[model samples]
Target: MSTGLGWRDGRAVLSAVHGRRVHEREVVPGVEVGWLLGGPRRCIGAWLEGQDERTPCPHHAVIAADGAAVQCASCQSVDRGLALARDQILDDGRTYRLYLAWFGEGLLKVGLTAEQRGTSRLLEQGALAWTFAARGALPAVRRAELTVAASGLARERFKSRVKPDHWWEHGDVDHRRALLTDARVRAHELLRGHGVELLADHPVTDHVGVFGLTDGAPDVYRAVEALADGAVLAGRLRPPIGRHLLLDQPDDGTPLLLDTRLLTGWTLAPAAGRPSAGLALSERVRPAEPDTQEALF
Candidate 1:
């Protein structure tokens, strides 16, 4: 199998699968990988080395259900320093755009990204709806992000759990559109008040169809808990929602919400039986259980 994982365009893909076959060129659509047999073999400490480099250190580390990768102790110290100096390290001479992304209901976040990447950033973030509020040089965009945060209009990140269940079940489209429009209006006014150039003409992105929730869309999975190391996940994959991959399990017919990040730094092999033997999707997969002695204390 391939040695590592990487993000292309706006999708999480496997670099290699059984037999050292490399998926270098094609974006292994979430649906494709979800249908395969295999699961996380082990967790490894991984971190981004540069703006475009992902380095997987061979150290056993804890992987979160939400797909957050935690590096080992030594790596964590280095990562902390890198994060503190991120502004200096990532300062390539490029324009950045400020955006307002809506997840669901009242969940929204304001963030900045390189102008040229466009909506790919939003797609990677799994935003249900988003609109550009302002565009400027890096410093100006950063200032606007801080201004928006200070005003309590939005933050830098929003959790995916805030999203409504079965997003397309009701009049979600129209209601979501209304919410985005209002958010956009408020964002524009706030940016303009802070002297940031308003981007009133940018189109709003609606990702209902992108996640395959549109009419006649294919079946997808919804995971309840995280996958443990050595747990084999076998199912048909659907387009991801945020960093989550929806898998349709063959045996129990249950949907699973898998964090794509868990796939990084893993070496996967095809499992032996149908339904991958003991690969049952259950809510029991948790980060860790509390100790009985600790509770008593």
Candidate 2:
């Protein structure tokens, strides 16, 4: 069945920073909230301060200048529908998104998912090995904040399409992918907040083609090599709608692609660079073993 909440009456715009701080408060009448993601940090739910944690629900629905709609699991999905509906502006001068990033330490491969409720999954083959955007760490530090805009009536535009998967399913993966083509392209067409960067690009091909190029079936190095090659050949990089890839270059021009295709873990360093605390060459790492197998990190 479809789950949803009714809109509050005459509520003002809600904004939260993206950081470790939990923004808990009541947004509109008849609606009580515990926390919202502020700054560039992921939107972590306010737990009882330490038990087995859970995602937070700010509101059943958001009513911005543009209009109103149900809150999906992630901001990225909801924002896709929003962008097609109307212009929305959050209090912090930003709208919403599915921010993603990648880190490395060696051969470990990983992936992550986020939204208004915080990280959904961080996997070593979709097997929740660890938190994607853990409370603190690498991917979190360099995470790229990406989003789409929408508001009141605008959100309604795509509600039906996004309702099925709830927030777990990206409202419009393909459409959102296209929007990421130019983060600023739809800004003029909608109302949103600041700090919005141009949408990064990812290949139009499937995950297998994009992530299957390296020794590991789903390693980020393969994804990175593919991305860098794609960027070099096509003159740009395109990140999958809900995924992230990190690429680094050594001073001498050696390139390393940090593989986060599994747990949003690891960093990419150049081949000739010294092995620091969290350093390892993509080539030196094994094909499909946990990075922890070696002292790569």
Candidate 3:
């Protein structure tokens, strides 16, 4: 197979990485060349593809879903692709996106809320962004929605200047670290107040709960994946619980930290002295029950 970075609309961004000459060609959706450089190793890559209607360069100005342009070679493309990539680029024109994940039950619900209130609540409850599920379990803010417009002509320009990394670190997006820490401290205080001992500084898997729920929740899965990645990047997490868990995997598997904390709302009082085995996607967990407290986030 010829090598290249393929955008969603079936166009290939051609370049020579090492001995490989990259060019675009057809591949299945949700799969692309993983990497183009180094050993005969390859990968199928996917990216946000869209267009830019107000492109200053006339070549890129007329946006179409599948057409490729010659002008502004670096960014020459359709309207939707530009729109998709616009959110990921920094003011310096470098493109990147924040990867985050969150663990815990109700992670998806916490991610959907628009108000910062959800974030503050999580921190106050002593939650930790310890796993991808936990990190991703937080919320995502739309790039376009966060930008402030100065004037009609300057609006797109303003958006173009916003950096993804900056937004991640200082933008309106709420990761809820402080709230989670507070929650942890409070949980600790409560534990101490009641003379309960924390069994382990960090608990390992004693129960396995398989969630096939991702069958219909791609967006939430992506956020959770990113959150997991961010936690790994931040030195807050490790890998699967043990070697047997690792050896049973497919060779190409990408396992991430799954935060059982997301199961925080599972049960306030342990089940027969331990957390219950979470149900599959079929039996959804609720935040409140007759005996369980509502989730912090």
How many pairs collide in each candidate, listed in order? 10, 44, 46
Highest TM-score among the candidates is held by which one? 1
**Candidate 1 per-residue C-alpha lDDT over 6-39 given as tens digits, one digit per residue, 9 for 90 to 100:** 3456565455433323355334444434323233
Tens digit of per-residue lDDT, candidate 2, span 196-287: 33233423222222222222222222222211110121111222222222233334333233222221111122223232122323342224
TM-scores for every candidate against the unseen true structure: 0.71, 0.19, 0.18
Please write out the lDDT profile of model 3 over residues 1-297, one tens digit for every residue: 212222232121222222223333332222222211112122211222332222233222222211122223433333333434454333322222111222332231112111222332222221224211111111122222121121111122212112111212221113344333333343333333221223223322111111112121111111111111101111112211211011111233232222222211111211221211221211112223254444543
Q: Which ten residues in a row have the lowest lDDT in candidate 2?
A: 226-235
Model 3: worst 10 consecutive residues (lDDT sum): 226-235
Off by over 4 Å in 1: 1-12, 16-52, 56-67, 73-91, 164-170, 193-195, 215-224, 276-297
Q: Which RMSD does model 3 reach against the true structure?
A: 21.7
**Which residue window of length 10 is worst by lDDT in model 1?**
278-287
Using lDDT as the yardstick, the better of models 2 and 3 is 2
Most accurate candidate by lDDT: 1
The true-versus-predicted C-alpha distance at residue 179 of model 1, in Å, is 2.4
Whichever of 1 and 2 has more lDDT, that candidate is 1
